[model samples]
Target chain A: MRIAYIKNKLLTIDESFVFRVKYQTNNSILSTIESEIDTVLSVEHSEVLGALRNNDLENEAIYIFREVAAQFERPVLLFSGGKDSITLVRLAQKAFFPAKIPFPLLHIDTGHNFPETIAFRDKLVKELGVELIVRNVQDSIDQGKVVEESGKYASRNTLQTTTLLDAIEEFKFDACIGGARRDEEKARAKERVFSVRDDFGQWDEKNQRPEVFDMLNGQIELGQNVRVFPISNWTELDVWSYIQKENIEIPSIYFAHKRKIFLRDGFIWSAEDDVVFRAEDEVVEERMVRFRTVGDMSCTAAVLSEADTIEKVVGEIRESKISERGARIDDKRSEAAMEKRKQQGYF
Target chain B: MEVLKIATAGSVDDGKSTLIGRLLYDTKSLTDDKLEAIEKTSKQKGYDYLDFSLVTDGLVAEREQGITIDVAHIYFSTPNKSYIIADTPGHVEYTRNMVTGASTSQAAIILIDARKGVIEQTNRHFFINNLLRIKDVIVAVNKMDLVDFSEARYQEIKSDFEELMGKRDYQDQKITFIPVSALKGDNVVNRSENMTWYKGQTLLEHFEALDKEDVYNVGTPRFPVQYVIRPKTEEFHDFRGFAGKVYGGELSVGDEVVVLPSMTKSRIKEIYFYDKKYQTATRRSSVTITLEDEVNVSRGDMLVKVGDLPTVNKEFTATISWMDSQNLNLGNKYVLQHGVNKVLAKVENIHHKIEPDYSGVDESVNSLAMNDIALVTFRLNKPIFYDTFKEHRTNGSFILIDNQTNNTAGVGFIE
Candidate 1:
């Protein structure tokens, strides 16, 4: 037996003399051009193969999204116009591709949101053609459901819970999908992927149902709804990496830009919006900064950075010595701030 | 990057939280602000060293009680792999939390205090891991600093644990032992200088060296339809795809498949993961698959390779880990959730209870209480496609939900 090497392609032949004669009769120039084309095809093929390797975080999130659709009749995505919520929207889209996102988005607005975030949220909702429902904390305040806190560190972040619960009751939503990652806060670390809330929307952190394997128990009472966190296993770094890989669009506040800011309690507070309360002695300065997280503008802090692009933002997050929630002033209020807020129905 | 899920189990004061904090701290996974808070809290409490347990005891009640009541998930990553550790408490509903934590994990770490080596809690932890069929297990003998970092002490604990290992029915489990002081950070992320007598790899090194490919048992591919994606748009007017996550094994484009329950046969036309079409959908990848022929498939239906069909049955016996406060008695009815599918099931019989301390099963046991592991038979309202727990983990398990309260009452592994 003999082997014929035909322009980088290997073929076996039994007769060596016949193989040599066949090779001479073949067009060498055409074979060379064909081999060059094969090289290009292989390169493109690997790129596709690379994408075939799905990120576990993305897959699990999408699976949870599908579960929500299958389990509940009235499900809603709790969109905050943040990167995490934006990522959730994309995952929801992917979960049911070619089809529109099966559920509408519910946004519990504090009315103290970054203008850029609101603009971005409206634009995304229009592009995706998904219904957007906005509930205002100001309405809750007006209805005497919640009282506005007035102080130097006062924020409307905690008051959003009342409005959120009201919205849940109004829509009778059985599942509210949100992008609450476990790695964000300690209280969140103990949350189940399909967390069940009572009729009053209270999170029973201590007595959570056991979630075994990939089995999610979405069973609930008539008035109770489950708070579904698809990205419960995802970390901040994973979210940023996924954003960069998918080239997902986020709020402009996430990227570095010239902004008027002030320092308070060792954190940079954006002064571009009048939502954030400032002291009389506080001095404002112009700095290139980006928000590591997007919450109510009153409580969310900015980090000084030059990461204007998604790639640069991811790179900065990888090397940064601070956690994503470190800039969240609301969490800094008390030790169990997140837990306290979550118990009151805050997503 | 690949993700590695792990569960930590030990008795109270076994330093499970400390070990997790040490892993996060040594890997530089903890941010500067978190460290500062830990330091500030530790000093305020008049502790000589920083109390790393504060990092995981998140709930106010847990902090007040100084004991973990619920499982807390901690995340850390090396350059190669990311780790998610479910730190569970070892008291009260120990078995319930341990089972909950270990169910999603590929590996588990059972911590043993060097001074109190291989106690009853250690036995229970090992028993749960064995029952869950977790492949990789690391038995870390913590508080080695208190034991003078004695190799002899470590060996004594290792041999005692080995004795327990002999009693385990699941022999495929791979167990590794390491001596460490999670407080002083020895033999955890870095090699221990105090225990130079032990020449094995550190806990982190051993985990890093593990073959990530064998984490989940690879069985025949089973695609449980989660949702139906029918765009009904102008471009994709007739497009009807069954969206699901492929479990166990890879599913190819042209593979002959049979829809479960209905038993409809069809060939896969295409496998779509988001926008791009793939020739094959690998295990655990959520993809939408279109069949060559339109099949009346809906949620709760499963797609499996022809000739690789699972057992379809309306009644089965399973080992149940009851987690509810109410006693699980025979003749009781509950909602049985198998993956995304739910069916009403009645407790036909209570066979026996297996003690978690390596003792033999109690044949005369009648009912199961909280944290009780027992064998029970259930008759479902409808037949479900299933597999044995030893063969396919995901398909082999189900959760019992209380019909009235909707609480997850128990978790069952099919026999």
Candidate 2:
């Protein structure tokens, strides 16, 4: 492997192409193809290396992804209307261009989402012309599957797990390609790119097998599903970099804007007219803010920031001391909030 | 900015959560809203000192019980590196959670109470770090004020830990000790005058000194085929691509490669990162590659360079960390997931149970229990391509899922 990389570098410097052939004579399908390559003397295809120093990172990901897409009968792209997922969509499109996305896109709606995020999600799905399956918390509540709690602190963050599981079962999606980045949470940091979920969608954190290198084991029986995160190794900065480079379109709520908000816990709670259970004693006022994360509006709090553009937002986040989830009220509800939700199948 | 994955482990009441909260607070990682929430909750609960545990203990049951139940991933960042700290439960019963947290981290922070010095939890914390082969271990002797800022006590604890270090097999690991108070402003991010006797760097200063090379250099490269993208369109006519993350090493266009299981040989025709092409694909970066020939490669099949062949065997020995309630017995069938491939495996035999307290092995143990770490052997229905966990961390480990419950029951490091 080292020699091949060196040869490629040398070829670039010398501008002289030298192809390496497998020396092994094993009587297998791979050896037969190698012999054919040796007969040709020289092999050629699209060999343009990325300008970025980190080209090697992108190239290997593309290769592994194509391999997994071919093996699964039904694989669904887990679209969350997030920047990371947007990058996955673009990468997936390039993976199989002109053929259209082979799988459907799945979204588990919390019913407490920001209007702008919902609008953008619908627009992207329409433009892509791909199948979109949205499972709702409202449906779950209507069926008495998950009760809707009322009050100023009410949130549907945990209920999304049940809706997501229901959607997977309804579609029989064996593979779910998510946009979850390992850098976001500790539970997520331990997650595999191809994490196995039982029929109930529980993630067994303690017994997770170490995912070495790029080999994603996609072996599971019927009724079992695998959550595939292509950007498992990507950090928040990486996602921001990709968004900036790709010039990807995001919801306006990510940018700075003035809105009627109240300070309940230091976070700016949007005093939107549609929101329910707002205490009269809670004071509401306008504030300059933008959301660091876009989740269920009731649970997702906005940060005070003047960084309207992507560049400034990235710059601000770089120097900021607090974490993205620090403003997330749902997680602030308790210490083990994320772990408890994950045990019950929360993504 | 690069994202750094880290994990924190310690015994119960080591103020692991407090230390984490302090880090976030001192770094200004907490937003104004979060601070207010903490204050309101603290006032409501009638606690004098703000409870940082509330920030990490996300579950109601955990907050009520005043302990962490499982793993909670907390994200914070400096301009240099964005950090994700997996705060795992410290109770002895949740050993599996500690393993889970440390598995993905490049760095680990093991907390030790200065008052109690090194205790049983310290051994478990160090054991998990060594087993996971985490390159960097930060031993933060927290609650320095409780020990009266005693330099002698700090030195004693440090020497005691150095003795325990004798047992670790991975010598490349670097260990650093720092004394700090999580409650008051101390040597976490800022150097402390309280510890005038000590002259080492602060916790954050030490973190700033970490180089990128020390973080990601795990082991050999292993590329497990994720999905195959074949855009057999009219314009391109034929584009057969293999998509996956590059592990261990990089793959370039025109590299001699062998498709595993089938053993079909081919050269990397092209490497694509989105629309652009790349000369090589580095480890951990996800990309697609088209082969020179139209060879058949599918998911679960690996594409590795011929010279660096991993172990392709039907049976092997491994250290099994049992994580479920049901006892692991011989003849039990389980689905063994190794890398991106899975094979039907059965428990062949139990070699012996290694006691958790760094004692001698239990040779006569019949079954393994929850939080039990033991050596065992297995027989696979089909040959699994693997490597010794020490040689290649990515290719050398696997997890066993119980056939009956579909629960991940055991994690195995290939021997």
Candidate 3:
């Protein structure tokens, strides 16, 4: 099908361009023949007829990105070097094709991230020609803003909130776009697409603003900002499928590789990093495993898999019986772990 | 694969959660660890059967209280389509939450306990679904096993629901009646041998056989420009495109379009989706379009076909659903958001409060409190181009944000 502007009117033509000829001829028989031909052509290409197809998730994300750009003066993307955030980066790129991504990526590094993830993050930023802003939880701890947790289950994951809030204040970002999906955790399921945060960066779960239809209310006070999750409607499989469809580059840890690991609480702990605390009795061994979720080395666990390629990884996720957040040790702490963290502005 | 969003509504103990869990379980969408957790929790609680509510009730308070407090999104996909079910709390107090869940959904499932038949809660659920113009509604008469799987009882409830359907304003809605026991695994994903007298599609079969294209492909094309994409780079110095998602219908290149608020006429020069350009833009697809001439187009401005212009006015009547704790009285000001456009608006008059249970309207009501639905008139500071809610879902609906707290106070559907 083809559309053209002729005589100041929109006209659609099929493969034969019979409509144009029929219009020129002004014959009733020719018009009937043209209609018949159009019907046949439409039926033949019915499967691929629609202009949208099944790209609702991507389209919604792109629309949210544009809304953030239009509504807020200064907006920044919260990049965690994870698959969800990486998908957000690509969506932002698609939102404005010829134009560069309007906002810079804000990475609140826990200082316990994998070296491979950091390298991947830097490379992605350089290739996209977008600015990268890094803030460290250690800096916040050194500044006496937040205290580091001690003992066995200590993770810098919660401490990163302080650094993130500080960076938001420093940059005065009115909107912080994150790649949090609703299907990840229970508390996240109740999140709105355009979530509002107060001056203290607190999320009011019970008294959330009602978001109706596609109209997003981004109205906020001077000190307050909105945490926009474009992919809130997307699930884990959707992200993997989108990544596979786009052929986007990701960290090597996502694929199966030989890594030194130890088992703790039925989870495979990466022994390659000193950030993960292991008891003396916990013997290290080599295993063919891959990371299902990318978080701080202390929290994220590896699943036993041989899915070495994107297609294989997507297939593994499709067939696997474990939820994505099941691999994240933070959620296993309590039933309300995600909700409590979210109320404290932990994105 | 296509994603179908569904909202489930039922009062407490109606087995709504179990029905959802059954759908997930039968489809093999629930992961092993999640199922194990549910099983462990169920066993610890010393229940004879697995409490499927544990799968959706995520909050600690909810678990302790044994009730859903808010809407919880549960995802599961079959080979044909991906499904996102908004598990809304079925309570008299959380009517606003139910509406919130149904607003974005294309379909809804109203669970009716077979023993109780169609109660007042069922009336409210059906009324809300009609108000939201949800296309597909499945009235699942659950707990059929408890009622001995009697086809007579199912027919009785179906007729009761059909009587309530007469009170609905929107007659175009399609409501299907199904008999199923959410807990007994009967007529949910598989046909029930006990209810041999009944012959109908199972819950999963009904969903699979739905015409997905007819769900959201109606109404006139309405494109509300979200943002203006301007690439002032060295290569493309003067590229300015209007970016937004197309709602209702398709828009093609060379369409004589008019920019709203400005009423400036222009033709669509190009329709670009990311790096590729298309001759036509389909409904629900987000694309950037460049006009033939450089018009003063900005965010919140709408691009529509010249012949199909919406009502441009400053004052209008709407059916408002109040959501905030504070009451909405006459003369109260709010930031009215219509699509991407924002304007200050004040309540001009309070018409009447419409009861959700198909009861008559109350005219003596002067103010609307929480969970109240009423017809109200609003005078906008600036004129907005809008259509009736029934005519254009996206163009006609709006949200009222409180000026002081910035909380979404009410949602209005234009009359």
Candidate 4:
């Protein structure tokens, strides 16, 4: 044990070089040309279009899903009406395929959610036949656990953390899987796959467990839990492409639709509902707008689009220059708004 | 398209973040909103050039100090492939962060300041890449414009690095050298006009031509059971599938298998990747495997072909990279996690600490501090089936957790 990496005796010849060795030994396995071809075939075996395309991400995601099932006593998926969470449900289904998804679905409904999104969420849950636990921000407000903010720039987005933490405590969920991709925001870029949270659900950004290989450390104490992000590597385009490839159903708000909207601070706000804080001077108008991220109505801003179908939506996403997080008004409050929110355990 | 994960290393002021930002900028990966934000921040900071570091240094303290504090992952793509760059801080204090960044990375870019030539930081960076066994390494000699795009300076640095590369055990690693200025955007995505004497593919070109097969190793198949799917539903009453991801080689439907610890033999009854059944489970594919016999198998139990058994031992020697504030001394107990398996382990003996600069090893050290890399032996409460790190990447590695703090204290590669 008293040594370094170089202290190893040169590796023995017990590796797959055995194929070449077999080729040398009487060539019984193949003809010279075939064996030469066999070596290349053995090296790659024509990777079935890719493990990189979506297969690798899909496989890696499924791996995380199973880890949560095995390592944690109780795990629940944080499903919103967004395409990312919807994709997570599909991955979870495949991870356990033929077997019902082991965990329940938790939606921290801000209560300001779009009517269409809530409808979509219920339908998907019904279709999956999994238990749905809906905890409301309105309930938190009613219970005096949180106070709703006022003013034009205010949103119920930050209040969801209180409800989320409460729900985690109530359910005693040791693992809460979310569809957080690293590409979404700057602070999220440094987050680990199996992110550990304290009893308060606070994230210690300065100190996180180092993840390596395909290994994830799910070890934690009694009061602490892990936030698992299976698709942390997937980009927004990758999500859409996967949805397109798998033909997974999503909330109708993602595609183009006519909606009453108002313009504020270079953002498109849905004027159909009075949930969002809007000034009187802000004139309402009709636009073919689609929601880029399906947060609650108060925070989520729609993107102007004419892409009604999935193919067109995928194409639009590929061509869209602005990031998905750019459309979320909650993030516009400050540069470190997400960091602060995450430190307080906002998923 | 393939996704290439790359790690970047450079000392403070070496422009590692700047190089990553330049890559994203040249690839048109930065959205207009992000660019506008950078412009606004740069203006307020009174900088003539865009402060690209603002894009990656996400934490408040990092921005205040104007230095990267941890590993930040940045995503971009070319027409050929998608790329994820893990930007790691290069200061000696962030050795653990750099090692963590390099562990998941398939390739690494060791940034060398052109004017400074090969420094001590370069040696550590290269040493980390070698320790992690990164298959492909690109030594980008940054800030060539400041040296008047001198080929002589780049060559001098390249030769020095090549000399250091001789000390690594991963002799099969591919190393390429390129000269560029990250701020001026030279040889990162496109060839630099300042260095006409240097004739080679740009840094992007080298990556585009990199095949995924070359980055990952394919070896004998090893499947570590993560969970057992027992669907007692009436539709499949007898259905009991071993859910796990296949590593190394392929596992066919009829392949005879052995469950670890149980030593029970069974034949694969079926292989399912999602709903569809396949004859073979290719390497790295997550699938549900059903055995012909109903032998006892649970999470943490490994399934492999009978002839390809790994080393099952309660005691083993390993190289550990300690990452904790508390010192790791002899007889310290930890929760040793080897793949899906967890076993209580106590340090049997302390070995020599290996310096990342490849200088030498300290044989007399009995304790490991933060960021200390050493070879130590451990005695486990139960035997874990494992492989040499040189043979299998996933099966050969494990992490140590101090039960008191629940902090991942150290990571080890089996010897």
Give the number of the best model, judged by lDDT.
1
Q: Compare candidates 2 and 4 on DockQ and give the better one.
A: 4
lDDT per residue (tens digit) for residues B145-235 in model 2: 9989889999999999999999887888999999999888589888898999889998888876776677766565667876666666677
Span of ten consecutive residues with least summed lDDT in model 2 chain B: B75-84
lDDT of each: 0.88, 0.76, 0.87, 0.87
The list of candidate 3 runs beyond 4 A from truth reads A1-54
Worst 10 residues of 3 chain B by lDDT: B208-217
Worst lDDT run of 10 residues, candidate 1 chain A, spans A7-16
Clashing pairs in 3: A321-B32
List model 4 lDDT by residue over A1-347, tens digit each. Answer: 32222122212222234333532453323334333543443344332211111267888899999999988999999998889999999999999978899999999998888888899989988998999999999999999989989888778899999999999999999999999999999999999999999999999999888787777888788989999999999999889878876778888888899999999888999998989888889999999989888887888888999999887787788778999999998888899999999999999
DockQ of candidates 1 onward, in order?
Answer: 0.36, 0.19, 0.34, 0.28
Q: Give chain A TM for each model in order.
A: 0.86, 0.82, 0.85, 0.84
Q: Write the per-residue lDDT of candidate 3 for residues A1-347, one digit (tens) a residue.
A: 33222211223332123323533453345534544543554555442233433377888899899989988999999999999999999999999998999999999989999898999999999999999999999899999999988887889988988899999999999999999999988789888888989999999887778777787888889999999999998989889977876778999999999999999999999999998999999999999999988899998899998989887787788778899999988988877899999999999
Screening candidate 1 with a backbone cut-off below 3 angstroms (N, C-alpha, C), the clashing residue pairs are: none
Model 2 C-alpha lDDT per residue in residues A143-171, reported as the tens digit of each score: 99988878888888778887889888888
Q: What global local distance difference test value does model 3 have?
A: 0.87
True contacts kept of 4: 0.54
What DockQ does candidate 3 score? Answer: 0.34
Q: Which stretches of candidate 2 lie over 4 Å from their true place?
A: A1-47, A50-88, A91-100, A107-119, A126-129, A134-170, A173-241, A256-308, A316-347
